[model samples]
Target chain A: MTPSHSGPSDRLEASLAGFDVPAARPPDFPTADVSYAVDDTPIGRMLLACDGSGVLVASLFTPDAAAEEAALQRLAARISPRVLRRPQSLDEARRWLESYLDGGRPGAAPAWALSLATPFQIPVLTTLAARVGYGDRATYGQLASWAGRPQAARAVGTALGGNPLCVVLPCHRVVGASGSLTGYAGGLAAKRYLLELESTSL
Target chain B: MTLPPFQLLVDAHWRDVARLAHALVGPDDGDDVAQQAWLQAWAAYPSLTSATNLRGWLFTVTYRCATDAHRGRGRRPVPVEDPSLAAAERPAVDPPATASDESGVWQIVATLPPRQREAVALRYVADLDHAAIAAALGTSTAMSRRLVSDALGSLRKALS
Candidate 1:
């Protein structure tokens, strides 16, 4: 990057002209509470994050390391500050994922943390996790009723839109009121693949 | 008081922190210091009641980290000053030329005291204003200005 100034420090500028700054991220705290691991999956690179409480967040990988680090930095900034790469910490989740990929039921969802951005989202997410079974589907309107807010179909969509626990919470099983698959965090194609994977096994 | 979103805070100040760090610690360690500053900022972000100048606050953290790294380097001496090791330690951008004024200027910068070097680098390489440099150095703007003036005077005398 060119120096912004046209001052008398030409020699000083020349000394630092070619210096490249590495991408900056939030510093790790002494209390390394949040642990994350990136793994290759049938879909793509995925980040699995867990904190002292439990597994809290996951993200689809970006194209390269810098982008991925930036993405994880964002996650760490918002969710928790101490984000460390601990592959062994995610071994159980990885096993569950592998089993699910190999055409087997994931029995029950593991203990994942849910620190939603808003309180209203709790009931909506809980209702989805409880009512939407494997190979089964629910319309947004149905999920709203299950959440005890029958008139909140739109809010239900918003809640699922921000779902951090993607496949584990089965947010992909939620559909439009007309039974059409709606937008998913993992693109529609991945959504279709997940639904098909469940349907065949059922 | 509720703080502005952490993402927004980082987006606004991260580059500035990195630039200042690079000036203080050189390229490699500067990057590491910048990253450490970000992590520290994020960790303390929630407790920030009211930051009138969040960018300056972040830069202050970065400055401390860079200075700590510099102090650590002082304990373990590198052979950069030795002519025998000149070929290995020479920076690629400006090759070592004995008779050039530019080489003389670089040498002058190398010989400057630690605080003077940091103040000069912040002024020239980071292109930071007196106010921002003051915050990073944990000094008043007037003091920062004096430091820069003193550094420039030394450089000019050596060159003349």
Candidate 2:
């Protein structure tokens, strides 16, 4: 179907000159069972995913393309594989995130989807969210005790390491047993930045 | 090779895929077919071995979805409203006076046998090369060339 071919194909192409297929709008497209967005923030590039109702996961530090793909693959396996990047759908979450990162108090917290969390991890994360406030820090041992597993400080660290909600769930607020900055999925630098951000906001 | 973000794929080829869907199934079912194609593509994307021929991959998916829509058409209830009414409601761009003649050409293209119609659409509408068309249609490159030539022959005869 070379355009230079001066014959029936050209004539056919000419006849189709004015034929137009309407451009599709975002709403006209089907809703992905899971929609995601990536944003660059003060700390690092973050990957966020949500079902229509609530956020499924947020990666505070998306270091590379492979990390993004890994998060997407996990979402596809656990939820539905029908995922698309629709940033407009995530405006509210972004706004809240920006506000929180800027050291300003955000409005109502975004809804969370804990489907990715194990049962123990769920309780551990819930305790962290409820008991830990902004500008306040808790030791891992304290968090484990608060979650009713006083002997499971090591388990609590493992759970927070895989926190699906990241900053939104306040996992960064949990410090080491001795109150030193320690392992965070986003790395220690991000954890320190988050901690300092909260302390200065006080 | 590391896979690129899925969003990039959607951004790059959505318009082409939409146009292909319209060419295959007409405007009424075009959006539905395209949506199904994208959803399926997303689901299968992570496991995709190569991102090298993504456009061809997308067109292939759209073709399969269009075919499925055709097969299921008889099982689905027919729309009670006039199809023209539905077309009128669509957000069509401003068409020139030659719009009717253009549509007449598409009508001719549509009546061709399925393979020929697909070949014509992939060639003219989607603006894909013979090799890309072959990849999408699962045909040999020589076969795709023959299909397009035969389809154009039919179009020329009908137009004359």
Candidate 3:
């Protein structure tokens, strides 16, 4: 009897592998309120998350695993702990994104989940998402005024700095007062790239 | 080190948990047991101090859940079917010819005593080391090795 050799244990391992286990479904409760996925876009690998109702949540440019993990932790802390990485679940957001990045306008605005935003950031981001088009650019002061907070340009800038939905909310479209490209979550180079992409398509 | 995102844990171990559940319980109850284990794990995740052996910790949770499920259903003997008949009766895609043989092995595994069954599942299904299996099963490392060896002996004898 080959006690340590490939026998019963080996057979058992192969048998176990033969069982057809389905993918675990997302938990039913709010604990798993957010589903996320990472996809490679023209800019970089971007992490996209959606709430239970399929509202678009965080869309951060994650260059590496550490960045993706950090964004996921932030979402879990701010939204719900039951965040699962289900890529197929984020299909609509990904489709919209792919279309937009391909220089074609997505049909409609995907619902945004601003759970990570403040009361102030909400209106600022909402205004930006609704008013800014694919190739349009606006100054931070113009965005603040559009959001009906004329005196809060700096606050608007701060709000855009922490924008949860990067490309979806068009944070890159908000430039410095003199039309110079300002800071972007994906960095200055990405901001320039996005701007160039939009300009070339237009 | 800080707790990594709970999603990472789910992504890494959900399949192992499901497979362990099926081995401990049966196919009918496996999904429910795995789901229960993940929910419980999520609830208790914040208090988990060490992330070093999360696989062991996850299997421990799954084992407890499977045991609870068994107790809830009054510990009825999981019905065993004739392997050839079971394989032939599957209406889905045609299973490879070896599937019947594999299912026969699984049926033998399913008939072991509870502790030996768990030892076998953790050892082969989850692919954990003896020490890790011991940690999940709350037994000594020597005890884990003995349980697995005894179970393998039973399997070989039964298969022969």
After superposition, which runs of candidate 2 have C-alpha atoms over 4 Å from their true positions?
A: A1-27, A55-59, B1-16, B22-115, B120-149, B152-160
Docking class of 3: acceptable
- Backbone clashes in model 3: 2
Per-candidate TM-score, chain A: 0.76, 0.83, 0.80
lDDT of each: 0.66, 0.74, 0.77
Q: Number of the top candidate by TM-score?
A: 3
Error of 1 at A45 (Å): 6.9
Model 1 C-alpha lDDT per residue in residues A60-175, reported as the tens digit of each score = 44446775676566665566544566667677777787788678978666677665345887788878888889999998998999899999898889888877677888888999
Worst 10 residues of 2 chain A by lDDT: A21-30
Candidate 1 regions with alpha-carbon error over 4 angstroms: A1-9, A16-48, A57-95, A139-146, A149-158, A176-179, A182-187, B1-43, B50-55, B65-107, B135-143, B156-160
Clashing pairs in 1: A26-B38, A26-B39, A27-B38, A27-B39
Give me the runs in candidate 3 sitting further than 4 Å from their true place. Answer: A1-32, A130-134, A144-155, A197-202, B1-5, B22-57, B68-112, B119-160
Better of 2 and 3 by TM-score: 3
